[model samples]
Target chain A: MRDRVELLRDMVLVRQFEERCARLYQEAKIRGFVHLYVGEEAVAAAVMGVLQPRDRAVATYRDHGHALLKGVSPEAVMAEMYGRVDGCSGGRGGSMHLFDVAHGLYGGHGIVGGGLPIAVGLALADKLQARDRVTVCFFGEGAVAEGEFHECLNLAALWSLPVVFCCENNLYAMGTALERSEADTDLSVRAATYGLAAWSVDGMDVDAVTHTAQRAVEMARGGAPCFVECRTYRFRAHSMYDPELYRDRAEVERWRERDPIDLHRTRLEASGDLEPGAFDAMRAGVDAAIDRAVAFAESSGLEPLDQLTRHVYAAGPEAGR
Target chain B: MSRVTCRDAMGRAIRRALLEDDRVFLMGEDVGRYGGCFGVSKGLYDEFGPERIRDTPLSESAFVGAGIGAAIAGMRPIVEIMTCNFSLLALDQILNNAATLRHMSGGQIGVPLVIRMTTGGGRQLAAQHSHSLEGWYAHIPGLTVLTPATVEDFAGMLGPALADPDPVLIFEHGGLYNVDAELPDEDPAVDINKAAVRRAGQDISLLTYGGSLPKCMAAADELAASGIEAEVIDLRVLRPLDDEAIVTTVSRTHRAVVVDEGWRSGGIGAEISARIMEQAFWELDAPVARVATAEVPLPYPKHLEDAALPSVPAIVGAAKELLGRG
Candidate 1:
């Protein structure tokens, strides 16, 4: 793994990028459903750090961070949100469906718990083909309430599939709290019943996520489907339209005290991996990249109306690449 | 020509696919050791082994979605839902993931998934196990729905459907599985896009597919006996309707009786009738008639179930009523 300095930069890149997305959403520059990954940067950054470029990752709708971690360029990512023809998904997917197969980001699935079965299938293929790669499926604790979650977990275990189920327990599934949504909030315990080697990690700490993910990836490669429930929280509302009525403001503030980016930055500084004032300079570079992404997204063209019916069904052998 | 059951023909088709493509595998409930719920995959598990002829748990959504996932990830997975009724559990995955992924990804991904399900009711399996919903699937744009009635279609359609880059749904009507038919001299390869004219006549067109094909043919025979000379057209493909065939047949006959085992309202019959109105209204001599299952949850009792479904007499009666000879 690269030094913590690089990890902090990726986290800051996500933080700075989505912070701009929040502002851009307000300006009417980017419309439609926008779910931000404000506080959960460490999970994507650390988990992706453990994966090779050849490996696949399936993520949920709040997936800008995951897309970036999987190496989708900031320009393509922002253009997708802009609904432009040049976006990673040609602006067809928008924020909820950011798919860049070249980057091995299988999808930006919009449905809750919808991507689990697909994830199991991806891993199943790799195993059947004897390909030495792991597929990481990222979903929230809320998805655990879905039957697909249980079904997929059981199926994956039965097959000994090469998949790592990373549950980012953001404590909420939209407006419902984890407690209200599930019988037992301990997602790891529930996963254990399915014969998977499951555990939870402190998602606020990038190192903890990295350590847990490295082991999980190893376990997956060894033909054991594992589950890692990262105890994290989204510092923002579920989406831009959310009224934020379900949770207490004090609770948000309390969780904010251990901000993932801030915690990682402090750790890097204490370990002498960073010089004083390094975060500011690093963030400036990331912000400049985000600015370029915004400019590119703004200049890109919208898909023509006549082409609206395109790709509904493939006409050729090389249909969907 | 050799005689073969629809079930064996379908099994041969699946077996051929597995032999031809290493990427092709069949996965579904009771498909492995159980030899498929309908026995359409009998002896496949032993021939292809467990890896290729995978048997999955009863979780419809997961297995179906997994098929989509595997298809997109470079495996040609043929997933079988025990029945169309059970497929409702996996509708979210099918509608949201399998059907929408290619377009949603801007054509960057296509789910080359082939989903097979048994449809229609005859054996008193009751409401849950026996109701034809292929019409409902036909409404989805990104999907290709096929209702293979003849043994030839049952054997032929799978190869072409497996070749399709997008998702394809094949609804094997439950009652037709054991029908015995003579195999042609050559391979049974046929088109998946056009309708097949089963019997040619000039009085009226009897349009149908899947299990309803035989019923329509029987009705056409009855009409022929009564000097009606009705033309029977098997609509093999459902989603991309054979509009040309539908219109041309109606133009030739100037009247049509659409037979569907599904419920009448908002069914495939409705869609076909609307298309006929749009394309062949001028040629039509009388209003198009639809013979569909009674709009009720199929009953368990044999008598009630028989009453609920479209029968030969009902189809014949509809044909006569349209021709003003009832």
Candidate 2:
């Protein structure tokens, strides 16, 4: 069995990080759109846990969780949120576009369904180069409405690209309910039409997500695309600016009762996987990391004004020749 | 030197790219078995096989985006959008992903992708297939737009475009595909950074690019017969415009006429005119003149379509009018 404490630690870290980010935003520290991954931590923790270092990942705008799970240092990501030069994207990309190319994190694409075709291309390169690597692309249920979703799915299946499309179905596209936006709310069923091996899992359960993600990655490694629909929920507003007029407060409380962190902790306690005071110790450690990250971001310098347009293109042979 | 059509020259260039780099591949609809919509990749499929020469479905967004991703993942992909008209369907991927990825990622990624599409009109293909919209693409910042007018450029431009560390769009004029000219045995090393002066003169400068280049050249010949020596400068690179070449020609000639296949209002010719006004206004003997297509969708009938696009005689008339000799 996987380490339940470690999994819980990861989920708690994401929870604490996002909570701290919200406080920072209120304190006039972090700017730009901050789409917190509050209730959907299990999806990233489990899915990213299965990915090897050589494997690549493409995430959506709500990507702080994915970036952390993919091994992007909390300090770098927090610095990025603060728009500091020490940020993962060199303070160029704000909250939505967290990119760590060295770790094979392709991007935190802001556009819905934009990262799918890119994941297919990354898989295409790996396939052509005879590399045994998988590219995991994460998108939300809302992306199903985009034309690129259909197009990318068809191409991945037609070309047999090695990609694991993880659709985190958080039940709402901003405020529109899944049933209202989609004709049929079954995302995995639609993906199956493209000849991909598709399924749905309980995203609230980390064990279920881990098991399904492992199988999906294995299938993708064998030269076939797979889709996983993680039926999850987002407890917070879509972004900090959202007033959340669409959903009722009663429904939020209902889903919050099934919080993935509390559920995972309860399961771990019943299974004797957690020692007494372990959860508190884990929280303390995570809080310490978040404190260090905030300090780093606070002390970090802003990028110089003169270098505003430096990274538009890489410095290549065409420069200063 | 050997005489060849622009079609053959481009085909040969693609063949050379495939032979030179194992990472270079061609992907588009009808690029393989159908030999491309304009036969620009006629023999590449048979020669390079299905792996390198991939024939994609009509999903422009998917394939183009895939090409961008492939470029990021260490492959040099030349994506063909059958015509500039159809590229609208793939604009999101082109403008948002391909163009912005490098800056978005803080230089962690560079899309070394080459997108080739046929631009301009002369064969009465109607509104959709006939408009020259390379100017629309030139409006974007992150792209390098190349319009190759000569057979030499057709044979030479792809190498440099592929070698560049950014996204490049090559707009090949549909009218010039069948036009034949002598090309060097070895591919000429042409730079995509500077404009080339087609003809030298001391009178009015006739500046143009793509399908309009030949018309301007013919217009220069017509002007020469009437004792008006007109200079011609082909703007090979449209995005990072060769302002130096434009200024040099206008400074010498003391007058300019920008000939473009697109409409006059806010077209590339307008940008060129504005540039001249900013840099070479003092050198002008008269206000700069522009010869552009009428502001209308290209018509289906040959006569109407011909009237809608910039013609050689129209260019000549504009030059004569600018020189006060019309």
Candidate 3:
């Protein structure tokens, strides 16, 4: 019970930080396509509950929340979003690519469905090297239809690689809804056909997601792969460019009424687990962290223009020959 | 040392790579149980098992990306795209992820991977399977493209390519796979970084690579008979071109002809000509000439395909024009 409240505080911090990012994106402080995991906060918060620091986690472009929940500093992520050299990937990755090798956050890939196979290979290496570490890969329901998604799941199952394939079903891929896009709306069933044990959890409930992910991770570490489909919603547009022409206003309002952060906070307050003072402190902490991150990013130097062509090839001095 | 064919040389290279390093493995459609579509990986499946000599589904993009991921994670992966033409399916992986990972990661990761694809025409495999796309990849900045045209290169270049930390594309000629020649008693391993002069002359220079090398050499032979001494330069490494050798040869010969199996406009031949002009424009006695494939899909019929691609006669004709013989 105590652990749940602590994790709830972490989730609150991530949610508050992302809400600030949305404001920043609108204010023109952050550029490029910004995809915030606002309604999907519980997905990261829950997954992080089961993931150890030694285990790996790779997510998609909507990954700021995941980075924070996975133990990466909100400041580093926000700094990366600001494109500063002091950030996690030296600001080269920007918002779409948030990689923290120190925290086992392999990357925040920009390409759609690009990180699934990479996560499979990471698990293969860990298993081959005889490590007990498991790699948890997070992608949206849109990725489930990709050929790479199928191939990666098949390989993971066949090799019995230690990997947990987490699908955050946000109901829409950019503008296309799950009903309009996937032939099989039941993503977990689709994953089950690949010989993997699949689970579908209510992504709005952080406890449900946390419990489901814990089992999946345990199963992966037990010499097999597992899949978890977290049924969630994106409260905002897919990116800044999206005009939100797909869904009805009523649908948005309905999902917004069940916002994951508010739901968790309500549950905590009703159960007498969290006080108003604690919530105020958590909000202040998140605000201060975002402020510091923005300052750090502004202070960090930009990479020199002359070094743009550097790291194109791994060959150092001899490669020039 | 045991005598080996080009096919066996590639096999031996893969074998040596696998045995020497636990990280090395082979992956491609039909590369495992079917023995590589061209028998290049025969007997490897039984020896290395399904784990190493992996037979992948027809999903080129996924497997190729997986190969990149594996390489990034410290494994030396050799991804075999049955033909360079099929590499188009995996273009996103090759061009987007594999090529840009090093720069995008801010030098944190390097793709220590090799993508070996058979290239060039002459097998009557039609348009979809018969084209050479090495020139397309060469235009990219990060990758090192190698065209090993001889039995020696087929036997030798793999070690150095695998030893290098960066990505290397080995374009094995589709025709040269069977063209056997007497190899040296010792491993006459050559440098994969420069152009090798196959024949020396003082009149004109013929620059070519891959399947076009034999035709250029034949043109050089024919030119010799016609009292036109033509130096033949085989460009083994295409991307990081041997500009020094090319400039010196063009300066001395005062004439040059580039023979490529690809199309003429915006082809590797054009790039080479542009580079020559950039470096040694004044030294040339005449403008550089080029013999390339006719702009059309390569047909399956023997004669039409032969007529479409650059031939020995075309090479000779271009060489003669450069030498003011035409």
Provide the TM-score of chain B versus the true chain B for each model in turn.
0.98, 0.99, 0.97
Query: What lDDT tens digits, residue by residue, belong to model 1 across residues B1-326?
Result: 88988898899899989999999999999999999998999999999999999999889999998998889889999999999999999999999999999888989998999999999998999989999999999888789999999999888999999998889999999899889899974558789988999999999999999998989888888888899998999999897898989999999999999999999999999999999999989999999999899989999999999999999999999999988999
Q: Model 3, stretches more than 4 Å misplaced? A: A316-321, B184-188
Q: What is the DockQ of candidate 1?
A: 0.60
By lDDT, the best candidate is: 1
lDDT of 3 by residue, A232-313 (tens): 9988888989889888889989999988888988888889898867778887877888788777777777777776667787
lDDT of 3: 0.85
RMSD of each: 1.8, 1.6, 2.0
TM-score of 1: 0.98
Q: Name the regions of candidate 2 deviating beyond 4 angstroms.
A: A315-321
Clashing pairs in 1: none
What does candidate 2's lDDT look like per residue over B1-326, in tens digits? 88899999999999999999999999999999999999999988999999899999899988999999999999999999999999999998999899888887878889999999999989879999988889888887678899999999999999999998899999999999999998888989999889999999999999999999998888899999999999999999997899999999999999999998888899999999999999989999999999899999999999998888988888889888888899
Q: Each model's TM-score, in the order given?
A: 0.98, 0.98, 0.96
- RMSD (Cα, Å) of model 2: 1.6
Of candidate 3 chain B, the 10-residue stretch with the lowest lDDT total is B181-190
lDDT of each candidate versus the true structure: 0.92, 0.92, 0.85
For candidate 1 chain A, which ten residues in a row score worst on lDDT? A312-321
